[model samples]
Target: MSLTADPPSGAVPATGGTLTHNLVNSGAEKVVFKVRSSNNNEYRVKPVFGFVEPSGTTSLEITRLAGPAKEDKIVVQFAPSPADAPSASSAFNAVQPTGNVTIPISAT
Candidate 1:
């Protein structure tokens, strides 16, 4: 059971202003995904936290607020969810993530 992101390039074009990436849960059980940005002050991530059922897709939208680019990156972390998981924040606090996927940002 694992999670993967599209746009293998992991490209967050700063000039484009905003970009969307889909997080797919390939696991058989429900999984919770937490999306985070290295520079939270400069970028806003929609639904920073969420859940994806087995074989489901969750879209992660990131919008860059007018700021010069640095060594910023978007990180996606995941952990299995309980049958009766309460909320994204709680579920995340309960289990340790199996892995992480990082997307690098670039200004072009």
Candidate 2:
């Protein structure tokens, strides 16, 4: 039940670039998670799919746009299934226990 993003420093060029992240399921049960950009005007998420098995790993790619003349913060939210949840799909139904991470984009 751990998540990490590459360029872990969370720094992206203002001119836009590709951001990659990885999620790992450390628990003994399957897990499902969803990803979305906090600011769609500034960033786009590709292949917005979520499904990861126990001890499984998945990655997501985000395309950032160049705009907003200042340092913009975009949060890539990840909501995973709870431990008691039957499965990834059920987790969404339960709608509890989730996590998120932020990315910093410098419009240089």
- In terms of TM-score, which candidate is strongest? 1
In model 2, what lDDT does residue 42 have?
A: 78
Tens-digit per-residue lDDT, 1-108, candidate 1: 888888643544555488888888888988887888888887888888789889998888888876664667899888898777779878887889888988877654
User: TM-score for all predictions?
Assistant: 0.87, 0.64
Tens-place lDDT per residue, model 2, 14-73, is 778877766666666555565656567877765454666677777767777787555655
Give the number of the best model, judged by lDDT: 1
- Model 2: residues with Cα > 4 Å off, grouped in runs: 1-9, 69-97, 101-107
How accurate locally is residue 34 in candidate 2, as Cα lDDT from 0 to 100?
57
Q: What is the lDDT of every predicted structure here?
A: 0.79, 0.61
Collision pairs in model 1: none
